[model samples]
Target chain A: MSARPQVDPRGPRFAAWVTSAVLVAVLLTGWWPLLAAQVVVFAVGAFASLSAAPYSVLYRVLVAPRLGPTDEREDVAPLRFAQGVGFAFALVGTLGYAFGVPALGVVATAFALAAAFLNAAFGLCLGCETYLLLHRLPGSTRTVSDH
Target chain B: MTGALVALGTLLVAAVVGFALRARDGRVRAREDDTAARVPAEVRAALDAGARVTLVQLSTTFCAPCRQTRVLLSDLAARTDGLAHADVDLTDRPELAKALSVLRTPTTLAVDSRGVELLRVGGVPKRENLLAALAPHLPG
Candidate 1:
């Protein structure tokens, strides 16, 4: 396949910080609506282009301009796959909260928080890492790499 | 009171992760044990002929830092005589990751002439540290 189109690598990490902040809010309050909103955010970000996601838009408008030019572009596929992993956890967590399964909701939200935290703090994309693991899993939902 | 406690707990979590990762970022973890640090035959042979050092970078498709690491190592390899870089795609090669005891993407190993692993960097490597690590093996 032709080379994957490049995007500023910092964009995803910027978005992750925002996601982590929102997740921290969700965890502390145990707020269902906020949880559901985050689930939708992850779903849209994963399935649609990152620009369609809210925090990403903020990054594009506010963060990109302030930062100087970058040659550190990256493939979009992995970012999309990572978003999907985030979406899955978000979906499960939202559902658990909606269905009164507080334990599941708490655990899933905590897990997602941990992943986001890693990306933001350590530049460690647990979602990106898991994409490979998911592909190898027996019943994984990874999108086949078009490349 | 409960809300305050939850906020405190979240902050604690973030702080812990920040501290732990700070300790690892760009730090070189040496593998001086001769027998244990020996490179796999396949990996050793993959090194460029006559090269003294091989920077074998194990990366996955989705890892953003892997791209940066690739460019960094490639540039270093090109500039230095007898220095080679191998970017291994671990997406389909989990076995290799296991073989090298890799814990994450962008993990880079510096293999020397004798097929001994000199050092392994777990995250984005500091160029100064990497250069220092290779100084003994690289010819001026």
Candidate 2:
């Protein structure tokens, strides 16, 4: 409802790269702890300030300084929404791995990895797209102005 | 190991989807059926006076690529005569989106002064492709 902060557009992409890596680890190892850690990472980005998220912090500290400063900035709301989407997937993955449902774990992690990989490699934010589409669905009460 | 194979398969599947999306994004398509559809008053009001054609972009608050598309469409409009760019935010107006049958943000509808729909582009448009598509409708 309030004015959201703007961030360097590349920051989210960088975070997506890390997310892809983490998700790939989850898929390869089928490790519940690793997936749980990724869920926590997604939680921080979704529920807290996106700029303060772990991967964004790393980008700000290490990656951003090496690149020239860019005037183009992006709103944080969509990226935060995307993190929430990722959190849901990662949480499902963690539960699946922990509860002897390896198939669910693999499928969920693969889906998350697919999304993160798209963002990292091609700048396509599937979660953001999903948010927009959901907003356009019939009987939706949410509005762009309130976002 | 099967785990490595599964991971590799996941990466391959992601790559294929990414490529497919890349191929489809920003490609303009003709919509002759929408010729009968009238542009909304809000969209018409956003058009430049005396404009022959307007690129009406539907946008949302959190759409990142919409920002990039705005820059591209605005710059293109400024450089061309009788062409105008207007962006309508649909975040608060889901009914408008539904009425327009817009499935995504950054969907640009090219309409004439009479509010007749011309062409539409989903996602960010390819510059050369958009220019080529609009050439016949534009005055030299």
Candidate 3:
């Protein structure tokens, strides 16, 4: 109800695009390192700023400048929660590849890829939905906004 | 061989899921039409205020499409007599969000004057579809 904190809606989508590309590489090579890099990207976006969240820095400097700043800023918390969801998937996917679990790695990356692609292509946030599900979990603090 | 197949298969699966989510965007589905449990009166009353019908919007502060949902529903409320718009932020009110079974941002609940639930829209609702949803609820 208070004045909503604002962020460019493009930031997350830009980050998703990069995550999707890295995940595709992860699937093709089953390479733990690429997945590791992606896990770090998700962590940065989850807990920190876009400046550190891969490709978002480019968007902030180049794309945001050319866009001339329309009034499309969004609330920041959901985007951060969304990034956390991405991080969980990336972390699990990296572990699967690291442990030689080919099927598990592929499955995790595929699921994460679907989510990232949905955000990048359709502007739908799968992580936001995951955030909602977390709130529904029993007997915990029901607030996701505080975190 | 398996990696190539999974790579191809993964792309195909991604495409299918993407299309499906996009298909459901901004469309209203009346739960009444679907035979779900009736929306409780206290909940409906919280949303309804001196109107023939109320468009209750469930939103979170950071939801992008919720903004679009607010603008459209408020415009509909203005155009229709005895129809009012109510917006609730679920960020701090997750219990209400859970009780309402809201899975996505900008989820909307349509409640009639008698407090019977009419429709529930899961995402951003298109104007045309919203008008049609209201048609049956509108006064003769």
Best by lDDT: 2
Clashing pairs in 2: A144-B91, A144-B92
Give one digit per residue, the lDDT tens place, for model 1 in A11-120.
88899899988887887788879988988888777777776888888888999999998876778767777777787887888888889997788777877787787777
RMSD of 2: 3.2
Candidates ranked, most accurate by TM-score first: 2, 3, 1
lDDT measured at residue A84 in model 1 versus the true structure, 0 to 100: 79
- Report the C-alpha lDDT of model 3 over A29-115, residue by residue, as the tens digit: 787898888888878877776457767887887677887766666666667777776777778888888998878888888888887
The number of the candidate with the highest TM-score is 2
Measured against the true structure, the TM-scores of the candidates, in listed sequence, are 0.84, 0.88, 0.85
* DockQ ranking, best first: 2, 3, 1
**Which segments of model 3 are wrong by more than 4 Å?**
A66-68, A137-146, B33-38, B91-101
Candidate 2 residue-wise lDDT, A1-147, digit = tens: 226588889999999999999888877777789999999999888887787799999999999999999987888877887787788888888999999999898888988898899889988887665555677557442432242
Cα-based RMSD of the predictions, in order? 3.2, 3.2, 3.1
Q: Which run of 10 residues does model 1 chain A get worst, by summed lDDT?
A: A138-147
Which residues of candidate 1, in runs, are more than 4 Å off? Answer: A61-71, A129-147, B1-4, B36-38
Q: What local lDDT score does residue A114 receive in model 1, on the 0 to 100 scale?
A: 75
Please list all clashing residue pairs in model 1, or write none if there are none: none
- Residues B104-126, model 3: lDDT tens digits: 77788888776667888888888
Error of 2 at B30 (Å): 0.7
Candidates arranged by lDDT, highest first? 2, 1, 3
Clashes of each: 0, 2, 2
Candidate 1's error at A104, in angstroms? 1.7
